[model samples]
Target: MDRAELVELLTPDGLTLLDSVGETDAVTDVVKAVSRLRAEGHAPSLVAAVLTQVKLRRKAVAKFGDFASRMLFTEAGLEQATRLRVAALHAGRFTAAELSSVADLGCGIGGDAMAMAAMDLAVTAVDADEVTATVASYNLAPFPSAEVRHARAEDVDTREFDALYFDPARRTAGHSNTTRLTKPEDYSPSLDVVFDRAATQPVGVKLGPGFDRSLIPENCEAQWVSVNGQVVELGLWFGALARPGVSRSALVLDGEGTHELTAPQDSDDVDVRPLGEYLYEPDGAVIRARLIGDVARGLDAGMLSPGIAYLTGDRDVTSPFVTTFRVLERLPLDERTLKRELAKRKIGALEVKKRGADIDPAVFRKKMALRGSESATLFLTRVDGKHAALLCERVR
Candidate 1:
């Protein structure tokens, strides 16, 4: 949002209108609300701003849960904000290390700051964008010990705080439609400077889960976090915040609960084996953390193929780190043969999962011309160095 729109939305009347509007996600509801608000003599700018926030708040619910209703968000800020559960874990690390104060540099919309402050730690949250900083201040208003500053992260003196948290801006400057800055040097406050500061004090930096593993500092703990099967962020912790004897970690948050797999370094891959009665798909965080081998060993499983993430074993073991599927039968790999087999089984609804295969699932599904009501998961992958289609059912 622009400065004028923000100015209009921050007033008592505008916020009251926003609250009154509640949530109008439907296009029809939004249009009707706009007409009614304008008819009631509300300013066009205020109406637009209020509705925009209502939509953003709805989208923010996935990340912030109930707290999103009371929060203000920029489109980009909300998109980049950490999940509340993950943020709480970040806060817990500092508290566990006995750090009472934190300098949250490049803190977009105060997500991490809110979590830290809620844990009763003093927080100095800084962001380069004025609108985002203002929104962060509003989100952090409930925490008396938390302060928001609109300034470049480099300008802050980090030595004053007991610990430091860096969430460098990875997108272009804007409230919306910002391009991702892929190069580490393109990040705001820059990785070089952030790592330099980490050398002397306790520091934690949050980056995308796909961050270059080679660049990870040797002295820090690299943790990849996934929520509900999706790998979200890779966090690097240095000094006191870094867990002892752990360098690589995968943190999985799912319906079961939180589970973590840690190793001194990347684990060695298991030898490839023939397909078993059941197949396992490791969670993305586990794969990204390079702990798939550890998980495979735990399940008494072997790789379906070298360098592929899928695992297979005859045991009926299960773990939160992997989704298990029972092999129903083997299907032909050729499109014509696969289509004929699918027709014979009368299989219609399907979930296509693949590893070490080049075919597009959508196109393949379309060609199958499915007409039956049977549902199954088709795993198109390499088994014993040959392309195979494993018709399976989810075991968990």
Candidate 2:
């Protein structure tokens, strides 16, 4: 990975070093060679292939704590990496038929571009960072129609693209210590700017799952995608790529099941009822999509509180959009008595779920120390500003 080694790897003479070696060993040697080249200030493209080769080896990637020391990703960016990749793949699925040519703006490491190219789409990937663009070029080399360009999204020519994909930088000028998007406007190229430009062509913009729902544009269709019950990315689609009457959708996907529920745009007052024998708490994405009412109607359930997201019904309902739980009992949130009762019932392990309760479940669990009992779900919440616990089982 030193200067001479990097030069050899990039030159015609060094090309032979990459040949006649096993594929696995070649990848390792390439990474080592590229790391040395980078240390020596060699051209970015010279190390692109090696970096991408490392990325492809999932086990070789740095762990969360080690990422800052080794990789270039910010802590917040790393936290959302898996979710972003899943969202990008899911969002791409929605527009697979119409996407012939795509422009991946801000193509970090070219993960999305690689996925799109795998789907047989011609992609022109662009990134402002020279190193990132070089990495993208090497990552996308397997696809015939894929090309990497060094440029900003606004400066790139959009005429040749059938669709545009954007993942904006969410950091601020003075805040290097924090990785989360501090302000809504921090979204790179800004959501408004991306949308305005995308109005000229099909566009897909990725946002954090935690983004405020009120900020979603009216013209675009917003989708909240969850993989294996974990809420991932939020996506906005514009132009011809948009779906009709589907302003928002909550997608819950698992190996054996997939559920998609769309929210109604028209707001109407719905009645709230008691937490019946069966209660459903939709995923965070479903709540963000404003699809609670739709879910209630579909499941023949009623709201527990006028503005709350909880839905209740008299009978067990099967739905992938939400987790259905049967209420076993409701009790006070007294640590001592609750522990006693749990022990009496032989419930050992607890899965704590909280809403509107200030108590820390971890501390509470430690204090209880009911190790001999079976597993149980403990729901902590404030009912009329009073804390309570509900023992329940997943209705599924």
Q: All models: lDDT?
A: 0.93, 0.67
What lDDT tens digits, residue by residue, belong to model 2 across residues 1-396? 232433444455334333322445435576666666568665566455335334433332522222222233322333334433363454465355466888888776566776677677787888775655654565567678789999978788788777788888665422125456667776667777797887687888878778877778788888888877777778888877677787888888776666777754733424677667877887777787777777788788887665666777887876787788888988898888798888888888888887767789898888887777478888887444456787888767
Q: What lDDT score goes with residue 47 in model 1?
A: 87
lDDT at 183, model 1: 95
TM-score, cand. 1: 0.98
Question: In model 2, what lDDT does residue 293 have?
Answer: 77
Clash count for each candidate, listed in order shown: 0, 7
Mark the regions of model 1 whose C-alpha exceeds 4 Å error after superposition. Answer: 24-28
Number of the predicted model whose lDDT against the real structure is largest: 1
Candidate 2 collision pairs = 1-36, 346-373, 346-374, 347-373, 347-374, 348-373, 348-374
Compute the lDDT of residue 103 as modeled in candidate 2.
84
lDDT, model 2, position 186 = 66
Query: How many pairs of residues in model 2 come into backbone collision?
Result: 7
